[model samples]
Target: MTVYPTRLTQLSLLALVVVSMVLSLTSAPTMAGQTYSYTLPQQAYSQSRARDYQVYVPDNLTTPAAMVMALHGCKQSNADVLADWGLTAAADQYGFVLVAPFISSYDGLRNENCWGFWFDHHRHQGRGEVEDLHQIGLAVEDAFAIDPERRYITGLSSGGAMAVVAATAHNEYWAAAAAASGLPYGEDAASVSLTGQCPGSASFHSVSQVASDMAAELDDDYPIPLMVLQNANDCTVLQTAANNIRDGHLQVFGSDGSSQGNSEASSTACSPYYQDRHQCQHTRYTENGQAGQRSLVETIFLDGPLATPNLQDTDHGHYWIGGEHGNNGKWSVRVGPSYPDIVWDFFDRHPKNGSTSGFPVITLIGNNPMTVNLGEPFTDPGATAEDSEDGQLSVTADCSDVDTTTVGDYFCTYSATDSADNNTTRERTVTVVDPNTPIETCEQATASPDTHIATGRAYAGGTSNLRAYASGDNIDIGGSFDTWSQVTLHEGVPGSWYSSEPAACGDDSNPGDTVCTDWQDTNLNHSLAGRAYYAGGYFSYGGDDYLGAVAGLSSWVRETAPGHYQSGQCP
Candidate 1:
């Protein structure tokens, strides 16, 4: 028997159908290569579920690729984070899968949810957030054909802080991690903000405190290598905070259980403590002598049983990633071939022990031949060593051809060893030539200021006196001759010339004259007697003092001969 429905029941059924339709219309669709957010089950506090992130899979995905998780800062969206960090270009070039997660709010503050690196002090904050992030990374790895062992994490600013937390907390999972402009857990304001009131609390761990905790949790002997980038001039986060974090980690990892002392002076504009610790190799990239150049400082603590290495730098700011920063404050999309090149290099040296696979094959430029002339020094052109496992390998030259005596074509072989110990050898021939060339000598000659002039030219028809001056190169002629004499032109003429005789007179014998043979003046020749000459004057012998006074008046001038100087000439 068919029964007619009551009016109230029919209306209820119609309302249920309308409600189902509305729910279906409002629900978001699961699209390809898109991230979706879900609300987590309600706990003590209203917390959100982990976000599900996906990216478009290339048509060719035969080989297993690496995966990287990029986390966003508080109040930042996935799109903005992607735009700022921009790792897609690197992903495309290196065939690595990339994922980025967004945080929407904190304590119901609209658009205020940041990574919990700083706010973890609250019971329901940092741990849950970190777990969610871990789940998301595993989900992405499972969804894509990614190599779990090759998983990596890196971030900037707060995101950078998160990366540090993840690396320290989950060191077993990440092969390598890099943090820029961010400190370990206990180093940031989060630590102070959470534990400021409880100053006496002994069990409390600051953000930086977490690094020591995490290091303790990991195999202390070989903890994962961490790369930190910081800026010395960063106005936002003082460089001291970063150094403190570095020092704290060093203290935790060092054998002495104490941090190195500050070695830099205040006048140098660097923290003395930083210089001292860096010398111990406890930090990386701490000394930035050049502008924009990255400093890498490292220290090894806990030998053998448990060793943890620490690296630090002071040339990066919040949002400043490793490498060069763009003018617009965005990481460049173009990853130079060298970018992936270096990443692989760091990775090869640090291997995931779980896998026995060899490092990637690398072909390097080999060394070339060089030539040097005899007596000429020559430096090797240098050979390049490459390994198929590691990219652009480093080469050490045996320099067999480098000898003190060998002059013929010599062969020097260069050997390159990869991180895996795979080695390759290359030989280069260098031709040493012997040439004959004369070694020239350079000498300079000097002249003294000395002159002997005949008075016959001036005293032609009558007795006249002649005065002469002399000069030469490097000559010193301040004093006159020892003896002086003059001979009369006519023979047997007593007193024919009157007055004092010339102080610098010729010898009494008249050595160079035939006329008036041996005729001589009794006094020394005073060549310049105060502008007076003994012409037709009587000869008279005078004391040495009289001759010296007349000789003092006669001045000598110096002159340089043309083309008499040389420069840069060996004597």
Candidate 2:
């Protein structure tokens, strides 16, 4: 018997693996299923040092069965995971395939025969062991007719933490996740050893922060549910870690840890019936009171009479509880309310609803609609791209079209492509405006006897009174004012303006009535026919489209400002 390192310190792990090799020579437990070795294909996108894995196909297993990836703890083999964790029996009973992958070789810093969950390279998808494990799962899925929605992952101790990392980093890959006696997502063995707490040190992000970071590019609409098993008497991992896991997942699912419309399930409820059943307290959390919303988080803490030691830390309560009776080994305890049974039940209820391409999403770092003044230098704020498979990708920005010297609307385009060739593009509008351009104003002289500036509101598509002076009678101007046009009066020639024809300028018979002169469309100025004149040059009220116009008699006009003009004044 070897004293396995239950914790994930590099030094302890290195020493433990040297002796654990002896146990592999011993005969494995006789399971109802057949177990075989699988060498995972090396992925060019990953830096994984571990590849060898094992699979257990239950007797009489059929197509469309569920698949579970079981990661083993430190100083443990894949065989130990299947036989010790009672997954072999569970697979036989539930008719699901069991995939047990372990660290076959010792990476310099990562623990030998243990998961690299605490290592930065392996914590995310498509990088290190995370990618290796994902490839292994895919390989198994291809080999067997596994249901995509029924995929799941579970682990113990260091493996437990890896399970969380995998499920979060690749949310679309797994339907559910369970961790037994595991550390939080970002916690390190050193910090956990010192404080016996989660979110171990400030050097690493908190559990909630890790969860949020993992979900930054994930779809929030379909969050993966999580189940955590904590041994209350376990001093190796500490029970506080379970709280961190529960709280972190609650944040991921946008739950406040309380039932919105459904009655809250008590955390103190424990199952007392099963053989050798420890006082197992269960707590469950749901996203909301929605009719079909299932529990997003669940926690089970086991505490009772201490069982005989299977290996080191069994007395510490850090081993897997409720395995096969009378056939216990390293980290395996024959206690009640079986861990495998509980995990399988939780996983069965939650399945993925839709498919995801694992595509990268490009998110603009700054404002989507940005403003840049004319003649000022314009700098693109840039963007960020993240993928479910590829962690972070380089974003290319094409802002060459955004010229600040010109007063017009422009766009800055950004795009990113992942290693898998999944690409995404995003655009931000850049508007350039000339600040020096003069704003047209309507100044009404209150006491001027020659002119009166009357300000009125003009509606769109109204009958036009101001005419361009056609062949004989006063004809309406062909161009109408834009919508919500403002009617402003300014002091100008009392006659109406006509298009280039001098004959159309005046009504010779009633000479004092309608006076007209040359007013071109190129210039902003125009003249009115009624008592008031369109004195102010054309100006935009908000943008370059709106212009000052004369109010038609039929148009709805409330006098914003009023002034009197002598009726017969002509210039």
Candidate 3:
């Protein structure tokens, strides 16, 4: 037997029920993470403007883990990006620290939380957004033991452009970078907007031109591998911007725009990440570096049928592709390739050393096997060392065991050590012989010895001239050598022994003496001059005058006869 409740009591019960339901629906999900906030004071690097940023440290984070700076698109908040783009979950699963910076509304170039990547000040190191972001990275390092070799940055749209800026401007601080639906670095707003409307003329600058700009602005020559993602139907950022980014990065990496070829991607050979979504075209660019052919840039183009009839639909346009369904914010899609997984995978392959480890690459500059006369003072040919994070490092040689008095085989060890305690060492073999021992001719040394044939042209640098070898019926170096008069020397001479020292010429040269050497140039990036035999000396390509130029010993020879040069001491 139940008693009927009064109208007042029933109304109170209904109100309590409504309040309970509201609280249940609006309660935030329990997360095994903690969020910290900070406001960077006005500093020179930040253009004397205070900037705010947030960091999300997931539970069970291990020390020396990778830190990914996750940037949000226009009109988006850090919290919105972390949740909608599944960055929070990615942090928890991947065990990485995430940093997100907020654009101040009071800033002169602020556009609804868009980063100031379009302006010149924002594109360089220690200036505007690039500096603000770098400060945030430094702040994170203070709180965590982030792997200096594993620091990476990625973003979408405007954030994508800013990521490019930060990664390139302070390139030494970052290991790798990824951008989705973003404009090329240093692109003006007018150009970007115009390209967005007219896809045909989307690329404002040539790929090589853009690459030159990027190379000029880099803090170090160590190329930062970049991953570019684009949607085929994206009308906002358009496919043209992605093309610019992909091609420009490839050019900077010295790649020829050739794909690494993944059969599972783009083709029907394998299903897309989402069966119902569009397929992705995966093209990877590789260059022959000191480490061999290595992947430097990868472009992921999402292609398939559109979700709507309108081409300008923002809902189906530029976004962080493959975000969680029903939980994404504006510019985040639930279909196509998974950006988080793809970007992280790419970043994991490339570290500060250009590999998974911190070890630097040590390259011997001169010849590997060298010959010296007994009782003659042996001057060791130096080597060049480079690390991805540390840039160029000082190389030290250990020639203590060498005894010029005795004739035997010895080793000269060259080593390079970085601040991270990572080290690399290389060896050069030195052979000492009796002073009376006759030097072996090229025919006696090898079955087939190529001729020391090369051409030279008088450069118009007033005092400077150009002399390079012609190999295999073509000018060894790519480019036009036309209109330049060819001066031949060292012809008919077998290329057996090459000198590592410059020829004594001009006031010091005595007549009727010939000195020549075949020199091999070792550049880690493989972008400059190549292996060639030159007379009248070889300049060290490792300098400011050329890309990836390192300071080293130059080789020179004097002309004694027509088309004939010999390797001997200068008189």
lDDT of 3 by residue, 1-571 (tens): 1122222222232222211110000012334677766666555443546666677777889888889998888866665565556566557756788777777543565557788777787788766777767776876776677989889999888899888888778878899898988777778775344333423244366666777788888758777888888878776677878888877776665545433332112211111232233656656565643232335777778774434311112444567754332132345644455566567656766877756556766655444446678999999767766565665689999988778788998999998998899988877778788967534332211111122221111111101113222221112211223233333322112222222111321233565444444323233322233222322333222121222234243333222222222232235
Indicate the residue-level lDDT of 359 in model 2: 58
C-alpha lDDT of all candidate models, in order: 0.38, 0.58, 0.57
Model 3 residue 534 lDDT score: 26
Question: lDDT of model 3 at residue 123?
Answer: 85
Model 2 over residues 187-303: C-alpha lDDT tens digits?
665634434333233233476675666666354356788889887766667667777777766766655544322423435433321344576776666656332245677788777
Window of ten residues with lowest summed lDDT in model 2: 451-460
The per-residue C-alpha lDDT of model 1 at residue 344 equals: 35
How does candidate 2 score on lDDT? 0.58
Ranking 2 against 3 by lDDT, winner = 2
Candidate 2 runs further than 4 Å off: 1-30, 194-207, 217-221, 255-274, 289-292, 304-307, 324-326, 354-571
